[model samples]
Target chain A: MSTATGLRRLTPSSFLLFVAVLAVAASAAALIVVYRTGGGIISDQERAEALAERDLLEQVDVEQGLDTLAAGVTRRALFATAGQHFGLFDARGQALAGDLTTFNPEFRNADWKVVRVGVKPRYTVHVIGSTLNDGAVLVVGRSLSNLRRFERSIFYGFASAVAIVAVAGLAAGLVMNFLILQRVDAIANTAERIAGGDLSARSPVADGRDPFGRVGVSLNAMLERIEELLTGMRTVTDSLAHDLRSPLTRVMGALARAMHEGATEDERMDAVEVAHDEVERTLNTLSAMLDIARAETGLSREMMVRVDVAALVEELADFFTPVIEDAEQKLVIHAPSHPVIAHGHEPLLRQAVGNLLHNASQYAGEGTVVRVSVEENQDTVDIVVADTGGGVPEDQRGRVQERFVRLDPARSSGGSGLGLAIVAACAKLHGGVLRLEDNHPGLRAVLEIRRV
Target chain B: MVEDDAEVADYVAKGLRETGYTVEHVPDGRDGLYLASSSSFDAIVMDRMLPGMDGLSVVKALRAASVETPILILSALGQLDERVVGLRAGGDDYLTKPFGFSELHARIENLVRRRAGRSVETVLRCADLEMDLLARKVFRAGKPLDLLPREFKLLEYFLRHKDRVVTRTMLLEQVWDYRFDPHTSIIDTHISRLRKKLDEGFERPLLHTLRGVGYRLSEQP
Candidate 1:
């Protein structure tokens, strides 16, 4: 196959196959060397045996005659003790002695060789040949089946070892892949659940030191922020509906009374007046809510400029003092001699301060002292409106700043509960905060805004 | 009057006619612009949203054509930014929607009055009641009257638009620069106090209440 095709088919098994091929090649080369060396050792031993037999025959010839030595029983006994075959051939190529019935062609010229001798059980032998003193040929052979068996055993051992190593490597790789995929699948499942609107679901962070763990942590934080914003929006919508329903119901009732059959002309006029008043009140509430909403949208950033908070407070005090006096309340305004400047929408700041003052003199009972003060620090400008009347309870102080949260509904005057909410929105828009504090005997509402 | 909604147009036109002013109504920006440029009118009331063209563009087009009639923008967008946009587009005044007719009438009267008196006047007088604008003082029958600063401003707005009905919203806006509704009867209380100073000993009352509408300060009352 082409290299590209081989690479495409390469997997964990393919890697193991490559390792096995390397091991098999090495084992086969080693076996060939061993077989050749063993055969050489066998051939040397056979050649020594044939020489010893010739020397013994020579000795016998020296002692006696050649004809006598050839017919002797001593040669047969020597071959049997050596466990080898020895044949002597004369000049005419005829077998002379030592169990050689016929002459072998392979034993004619070469010095040594491995040749098969028997047919029934096929015995391979290492054979050595030499020319004798009387011009006769002598050949010696030794069986080599044991060396072949050893070679076979080595080959089998190497093959099995390669197979075992490759299997172990592939198993390890698969186990690691499965573990990683399980972790990744867990993360994906959590993401899917969150996408399906189950924001309560969170990604599992097993090891925070890992990259995936960090990503999960960040995602969970983002989800928390989203949930918080959604909850806040829901609360605002619910309260808006609740606050608008009252005036709407009153208007509907007045109109129904006006349309009733038993209503006289005076009663009809009174109903019309009542409906008009209720409609105006509803419009006022809606407009105030819109103002708060606008501040929250952050669209007023373009209108931001350096506002003289002290000047604005002075103006509000001037406008409300008469109205407060008419309500039979004492109004005191304290402003710094130097200009107290901050960054915000001037009109919105005026409205926020005005709302606070309005709340103070209106909610705080008559004969109460209402004080308006403007103070500046290094970072913030605080416009505080304090009254010496019954203040909001400690727990209710925070709740009172929420939209449409009216305390003691039975004690409500003509004002909607959106004034402080608008003030809070404006404070947030200006990158500041609103705080409600106790003035010992009354409520002190402070609107803190960032300074330029 | 130029308003796209037929109901609103008829209602405003009828109200103006009942107040004894000759009125003309158009329900589209194109027609309104055409009539405004071709004919002479004392004043124009334009809605911000119209059929053929928007009110701001119409005002821009009229100003570009040199039609110098005073224009009052009537818009449902009551934001301070919207008010700034309308005035910058050459509208003499900006009135938010769902307004009381008395408020609309008062704004339109002020716009027309501003256009009529282009030359600066230092003194304003309604019969024996007189205000010296440069001196910031008020006099009745050659006798000096002591009035609070806010009352003086209230009387000054009245003197500027004498004999015309001024709504409570107008007084709050023109005098105190407050654009919100007065939750209490602050204006009424202030007006009663000012009346005590202006007509307490005088035979004739200068400030007359038009129930269900507003107050009209005139010699006849």
Candidate 2:
């Protein structure tokens, strides 16, 4: 089948349609020929019948008043006709007159006969009427072998025509299907190349405006779009690197110069702190980018195990209480009596909590109460960290979860803008969701992970 | 932060010393390693970039040579990749440059506290209190003192802190340094535990919180 397709492929739909069209045309032609030829042939049969009647009239007195010589001459003339054959039966179906005939008395009474007489089947009829002296009837039959010969030739011609038409249909359909499959294969090959990362690859354009050509055009457009996006990403990364390096170099230079100048204790200390903060900001940016990249691989979330959510929350509350108190903020922790165990990476879960605490202290009013709570259910666990501060605008809240997407200006805040990003990354990495919700007068960040 | 960048090295060193730590200064890794190896410092403030060798390699060398001094690798290499390399290279902890003085102080203390737990005596002792490591026995001046495991560690850090105003960060770092969660109140919980253990039924209160700073352990009560 594959070889046939390679040599001459014919899909069944196209082949059936082509053959149908050809068969319709051939059938119409055969019908026309059969009618024209059958009319002449049938009329000839009628003429033969009339001639047989005339012969019967000429022989009417042959077995009665006619001399032997005249009867013999009439008989010879009647017998010479191609369809002539005759037999006469008495009232009781007894054979009375015949020539070169065998009698079966039981067959003589039939009104019509499909008889094989002289090596050919023929249709004949017998008639009986009161006009006969002894109530005898003549049974006659004519050979239809000549008609069979004519019908056979016509049928054979039609059959050959059908065969030729079928072969032609198959040939045409195969060629057409092959051409279509070739064009389709070209498009598929181009797609494979593009999937293999050849963004410049394009489908072969067909000569005319077939579907393949239109598909090629659209595919090229899609490839162009992908290339544009990739280029934009590269440009952004380059710009980011360049922009970050300039400030870093300046910071380092400033620190280096202060030391080279042999500054006083206070002067040197001041320079160090400024430079240190700058470096930390840079590091925070880089870590945010890395976290985004890792999450972009769709969050593998490894080694998830049952976790004591209450213990974790209580732990965080204990860890942050001192820091929060030192910042003059009130830290309140609420954990249920039962262990609210979830399944996820402990470090990532902890990091998310840390980010929440860190972010709250930096943004929330220093003396406000920050509440941390752990709530659990049969199938899931939730850790909520809420702070009363200038809560993120509903519009900016979503963007804040993205790396470097701090809607608030960095200069106005001490944060590196990575705290929320880290929270977002850690939440995702633990197969959990981090959402910013309205805390009424404050903002609430909730991290919810499913239980194993 | 024995950073060759004198400006950075001074504040890091000063900030550290101001936080009640004894910090020695060195401008290069060679001197840093020499000072670290020659004397058993509680913690070494390592600057990632130095004149003689990079900070990562110095830590790696120190670790290779079996020098158990906890090194807080300070670097401007703020990238995650750099942090990974620093930590993987035997740095006990990592501190990005341009860190707040408080953060730097906290991290240094945290690193030291973690290392202190590994080799320091498992049996912690404080003012008329003796804890036997093998025996798992606690005594208040030769009288058996019943205390939970948490109370023991809490008192241990208090004794370690001695009379200094040990902040909450110090307590958390010193006692539960294994936990990465810095947003919780484990310190307070542990402090209350120690208070219950050491202060209960006693004429003396050995553990005291210094309000904004930390707790202190003393016999002055």
Candidate 3:
């Protein structure tokens, strides 16, 4: 492909300028050809008028009307001599003698210019009447000067018009480039900066009337979303350290006191167990925190390695099959025939799906079905984990995935309340989304990732 | 000197007394200033947000009086601005609440020990004991004494204040960071261990105990 094809290409200004110059040249050529070819009829009529005037001159001593001052000059000689200076005509509207020797039929009755030689020469034969006896008129005319002048003016006009049009085309080309391609260039530059790690950069949004402006608005919206997602992520990390450490200090204190002041072996053992539990809680919290932080900061776009979504779903199903059987609960995984691929971090995605399965197995009652499905629908890839347990309420579902929020059952059952929240954070980090819906009989949680 | 939150004041005051400090607790900025003006302390523990005069104003007043008392500020606003306010008010150190007790006590003790800057350096020895510090170790009768981290720090502070009465609160601030007056047995506890290791086999003990007041490290047996 040419540099002007695909992604890398020559800009629109050069392209428009090329087309404009080509159009001007083509127009000038066509008009020049028509003026030269079809306009020869005017010259042909002048030549015919000269021939008619010459015939009239053969029957008359056109210069006998001149007095002693012109005695040496013959009629034909004087008429021809005068033709060198001007075209001459008699009363008959005909050219008598000149290089322009014919009277064009179309112009035979037209009044002709009549020039007579001599002042007070008693001239009577050089007249435009029957008295001249077929001396109706005679004109001695110069050849082709008017036609040449007309053609030269047309050439000059064509040259000036082309020059003016070319300059105007240049001006219009610059305006077109700035208004159209230049705006695109501005957006591209901003995108380049953002790609180069300036997340604070934003496209200059013009009025949202033209396509470029609309694109600017759209890009700004996307960039705003990106900025918000990143800031929220930062808050979560800072919150993690600040919030997690407070509880940890108290736990460490309790354990330290128990170690130092426990009265008996049993008391010491109890304290040790409690400390171990706190440590475990801290680890679980950290795991959830890292997952959410990574997902919220748009880490997925840089790592677009493809993974088989269907295979992952099947593998998860197989891994959890034994647990399901042991719980006397039904487990079913539905996948497409063709391997549906999604760009993602395989380990993280698997962990997310695993967490869902773990939740389902723990919360969904025995002898109940835990349905899992991974499917692709045009622009989206969805991994769903649904449980036959009581569905989350409409009002509560939104809050369920927030950090450290859990339904009553999950909370009572010793959950950290961070499972769904982590999942939501992961989806957002990947520029994806999570949807919580009722499965009519139970709750359906969907992890919807965009197919990049 | 801290007069902000009641709970924190109680915690810090009790921790200080346990570390062998004579603590005069106040409730708010007004009372704190009145107590500070009327009394003399080796060090002042100022809390940033007080009821009336505030920790900043109190410290400012103290500094204005040309009272070069070593002051340590306490605050719960752990942000940068709070620290600036404390330091600008002439506090020698700034520690936020929810802090470890040991750290606070240690800071206060160090502040006071430095404040009592004696002009002449005093040589400290017990029972014809002699040691050269330029050599980086101590010896008694040409035998080196193996000291733990805590014991070494305790001995060094005592050596620096050789001829003076080193209070338990002074030792706590110099050694441990316990800031409250829990009236606990921390000073006695650490002193016992230090005595056992340093003067166990000796005929006379140089470490002396002052009942109802505090313990002191002396050069006489």
Candidate 4:
């Protein structure tokens, strides 16, 4: 309902959000994999080291007594190692012997787990404890700072990756928004120009593969059609003025003569008659122009029905036959006996075909033959009126089909010059085409309509 | 008369007066409605567009007030479907503008005569020509005359308006119901043929062609 560019409503920010979410998920997955593999390696190694120390202490305790084991030189060697610590405790949980006994002892019995014990620069140590048979306790701890450092590095890297991906997605979204707005603005500006009466204005076409390009093509086509219609309207207006003004002027001249003081009664009567004739002629011209306008605007489509083209053409031929024969011309008709139906308004079709036949009668000349034929194909029915008189020049045939474009001065006397124009309009309204072609010795006017 | 244009109203009123009919003209729709409802008249000629109210509204209001005087709507918008709208708005008849005065006068008289005759009549006679409505038969001077269906309808219209001028347009509209004009002289051909049939063996010609006006089927001529 807003008629605004839909780009803003379906904004590019949502796409940016989606990209950001995917980046976060991928970064999280990488961090989790790194943490699990690295942590597992360090924990497994630390557990093995603690188990070996515990086994050593248990063997020494079983083979020798707890006091003898604590007093052995091997116990000192174990405590003296670089990344290992050992402790011996009595049943009161006091460290009897170890390298560092100054740490607090919060120990669990018979378990292997990591413990943070020291105050400054705390060491995350994986420790194992066992209870000897003589009510003594032994503990072993391993340092894990190297593994922790590696994991911290991986975490920082993942965090920065997520931040960079999010920023890049936002920048891309902004650029896309700018491009879409530019294209939309171009279309709106072109439409505004066209609405302001610049019918020649058109939108710049984009690449054919993109939606914007297709939209531009369609908009340009619409503008072209509007321009054509506007140009046609101007032509019709000018022709109407030129056609009606002459008759009106003649009427005025005749009336002026009748009103002259020196005119005799009989002369004034003749002038009155002339004035009346001119008035009628002007009215006829105006009416014909109106009819053409009406038909061209599709006002007659509301009266559409199924019309038999063959029957209609035959009837028209019969009606005009006597009239043509009376004028000393031969009238020939050729039509199918079967019904060839089309969707149309009967009166409008009649008027269109009648105009063509009347043109033939008037312009085919005396003693010449005018032939009307109805030909039906799969989808169309063509009613053709051909005459054996002086035909229109090939170059002027197109112009003569236009309103008020009379090619023959001698043939232009009685007609308002809208006969063919009306026929063409009617044919168009009925979803058909009107063609003017050259007969062997005359003109052939064909009005083709869609069959029902 | 209800019309906005002074020239048109004056011209129509003068023509009606020349034809020996009393004329009264009102300029706009409001006063026209007021006078038509309060007084009695033979017929009212109303224009479609007026200063106060439109012709359709005025007709609707009068008909609502039970004013049965015949109303003829005159409009400049003569599209193919416009006449239907005018008649649907309670107008007795609709005539488009740029019309000949004879056609207008004939239509107005027809409307008035139609209003005056309330009861249906089965037989119509103009001088020696008699037509039976139910039998579809015509007798001229007590002699049966054969007529085609179209000729019969044309004669019926002529007999209906025996002493008045009926224009070619009136005939086309009343008989064939064609609103658009034909470029050929179809009506003239039909009329000439009908004239030959009616006057071929008759003593006096009842159909008279008035130059510059139209045809009349009357005994006085």
Best prediction by DockQ: 1
Docking class of 4: incorrect
Instruction: For candidate 4, give the lDDT of residue B44.
Output: 96
Global local distance difference test of model 3? 0.65
lDDT of 2 by residue, A222-258 (tens): 7776786587468548746764875598698769866
Local accuracy of candidate 4 as per-residue lDDT tens digits, A253-350 = 99999999999999999999888767766676666677677778777677678888898888767656546766678888999999888998776677
How accurate locally is residue A273 in candidate 3, as Cα lDDT from 0 to 100?
60
Best by TM-score: 4
**By TM-score, highest first, what's the ranking?**
4, 1, 2, 3
The native-contact fractions of the candidates, in order shown, are: 0.12, 0.09, 0.00, 0.03
User: Model 3, which residues run further than 4 Å from truth?
Assistant: A1-211, A295-308, A321-330, A335-344, A362-368, A376-381, A395-399, A402-417, A425-432, A449-452, B1-221
lDDT of 2 at A160: 77
User: Per-prediction TM-score of chain B?
Assistant: 0.89, 0.63, 0.55, 0.94
lDDT, candidate 1, A111-161, per-residue tens: 557676645666666666665557666665555654566567766865676
Off by over 4 Å in 4: A1-114, A117-164, A167-171, A181-185, A188-199, A207-211, A218-222, A256-267, A291-357, A364-398, A426-452, B64-66, B79-81, B118-149, B180-184
Error of 3 at A265 (Å): 2.6
| Residue-level lDDT tens digits of model 3 in A1-452 | 66447335654765776778796978688777868774576655655665565445434445454121122223444555432322233444455433333333323233333334334542211212122333333334433445666788777878787887788887888887777777888899989999999988888875888788888888989988888778766766676776577558868876886768535877776676666556545655664565556556554444446878898778666655656665678988888878887777655566567667767876777777899998778988989988887777899988878776667743455556667776786677555888988888787889988767
lDDT of 4: 0.80
- Return the TM-score for candidate 2, rounded to 2 decimals: 0.48
TM-score of 1: 0.68
